[model samples]
Target: MKKLLCLLLAVATVLAMSVLPAMAEGAEINMFISSPEYADAVNELIAAYKEVAPDVTINYETTQNDYPTLLKTRINAGMTPDIFSTTSGKEIADYAEYSYNFAGSPAAEAMDPAVSAMMVYGDGEIHGFALKGNYFGMLYNKAIFEEVGIEFPRTLDAFEAACEKLSEAGYQPVTTGFAEWWVFKHVMQHFLDAASDDPAALVAAFQKGEAHFKDYPVLYDNFFRFIDLCVKYGDNKPLETDLAGEDAAFGAGKAAMMTGQGAWVEADVLAIDDALQIGFAGYPVTDDPAKSQIIGGSDQALRINKDSANLDAVMDFVNWWYTSDYGKAWFCDVAGVIPPITDAKVADMQIIQQGSELSATDGAAALSICYSSDSFNQAMGEAIQAYIGGTIDKDACCAQIEAKWVELDGAAQ
Candidate 1:
């Protein structure tokens, strides 16, 4: 009887060991994504995840400059990261072939509907997730606006008048981050929204070579007028001012308004002057104040490589990041970002609070920037930069943009 009991115990122990998860032996997941601003927060999240997944390692990497080009190079070399990122909407489809469709996964289920809506690809398969839902608009120094005795403008005419007031009061009216290509997409989307009731459909038509910028006065006339205004009252070197330059000008209290930025810059601006009175509002796209509504939704998407060597481990980490209590709270507490998951607490930052209030009362415009891929956006930026540099006239720039939209995006279709 004693011998039989000992043999039975040994057998049970062996069965338990055999049934243990493969994770017990350890696995490494390589995650290379963009939005380097969230690197610290992500590192913290990775550290916390280590506790739950002690045996699984996550090798994280991020970049802000030429991220797409680098990612494509790695992908072509057959060295795709276990996790990667692309813009949420049309680019989701651009990378669909390489991404996992984890529609029913816990991470996908936890995603906020507004965000998940952009992550959907063919037949409703979820191809990606976001670090945070985003709000795109203008950021202003409230103190300067008050000192200049003018409100943040909501109409093109009002914006010009306000710029005159700000400039007269010895302040740069706007710090345009025109040096970066992505900045053009951020600023152009507001004008795009004002041009059409269904901006997505309009974008598709343009991509299909069925639409022209000349047809939309709001885009060709008012939009260009606004850009001219920005350049007129903007940075001394409008074509040379990048995001950091904008941040420096605004944070130092030299600029009254900052364009081509949104909630993401709040922390950095505040860091420069912790007591800075940051104000958030949409661009003055036209004469209609209502049409200048703020844009909201996640513009960036983080995707899982469908063929990752440690696919299960990657999914496990993502699930834990979305569903776990620590993970949910990290967005607000650590990242100080708008939560991308439902039922999570919002950050107390000024831009976030103002954005939520504006979104509730005035409603936000669709995130029109996502309707097209970054490739077209980059080309458009270059053409516009040439226009700003006086190398190409406005008509020439418009012609180039329309042709490139059809050539790059239309071909993909």
Candidate 2:
């Protein structure tokens, strides 16, 4: 019995020795991102990265709910990932303490200036690089538009006229998921863009408590215009329709158009009916053609953890991701995004082509930057709902947003 036990122990020790070298062949770099929906795309990227660096394993992790809270908690506990995901602006600012300064990287050199401006810290160091961008515009059913004999609207009046036409054709002019608070936040992005092309200045002023939403008549007027559109064109029970259901509704041809939609919605709609042809156009909020623009910016950006144990391996992957064909493929093909890098190749998807054509103009800007991080969207959503339901006037809704912004600004200080 004693001889048998010794032999067994020796066999186990030899098996452990054989496995250790295989494990040592690669360094496992942990990556944390928030969108579980991107699992397939992310997995494809991970596989591509493995092909380039077989010695480095990319450990990708994702969560869909309360990601920011979980990320902050992880950082606070010093359980830092090798690579982390961030948005372009204030989100990167808040995570700057744990992020590496990538000022000298190839990715930094390849970034669009506007994107760089958003990702750079106050100290003049770039903390992150935007990999891909998505645009927000009016996504319309091409077949529906053809049937109604109307072109995509380019001005507020034209938009309203088209809505009337759509309504006359026994269709909902616009499909909106106002029941979900985040939908309003995303939809209002176009209205905000039409009000000010350079919203960073306005956002800064509001942050400093020097500007009010009511003080800017263009913005104030646009707010009411948006509310009117919602009430006039939205589904009978706008508040009851959810985002997922809304996509299905649009794909099913229950509506003629969807305003303030992004590329993902196109994908969602297509998933329901592959042959459904869709078109993209700017959500016109003003009579001035110059103010009518597409809303877009860094949809997803990557940041490196400064204290990563596998910093070298992580950076090697980052360099490959930003410069290699694999990276471009991941952005252009796998993720269905327009790569944020200058001169980056774009996917041949028709929806992407339509969005790119609209984004080429001078009016394209990132409108989400103007949103205050603290409950501002929630407050605005509530106010917009009140206005839509006739519980409050337009002025009251605007005032509520202003007050919420001011209150949040104060709390931040």
How much is the lDDT of residue 13 in candidate 1? Answer: 100
Candidate 1 off by > 4 Å: 1-24
Pairs clashing in candidate 2?
Answer: none
Clashing residue pairs in candidate 1, if any? none
Q: Which candidate gets the maximum TM-score versus the true structure?
A: 1
TM-score for all predictions?
Answer: 0.90, 0.88
Distance from true location, Cα of 314 in model 2, Å = 1.4
The C-alpha RMSD of each candidate to the native structure, in angstroms, is 8.8, 4.3
Local accuracy of candidate 2 as per-residue lDDT tens digits, 1-413: 99999999999999999887465567889888876777888898889877878887777899978877888888888888877776666666777888999887887777766567667777889888765666777788999999999998877788889899999998888888777776676767666655565666676666677777777766677657865786679878877777876897798998888754677777788888888888876777777766666776664557889888887887778777778877866787788777777657777776678767767755575756434553666777888878777898877877777777677644463
**Which of the numbered candidates is closest to the native, going by highest lDDT?**
1
lDDT of 1 at 324: 95
lDDT, each prediction: 0.92, 0.75
lDDT of 1 by residue, 1-413 (tens): 99999999999999999898555368999999999988999999999999998988888999999999999999999999999999999989989999999999999999988899899999999999999998999999999998878889999999999999999999999999999888888999999999999999999988888889899999899989988999999999988999999999999999999998999898788889899999999999999998878888899999999999899999999999999999999999999999999879989999999998999999988898888888899999999999999999989999999998999889656
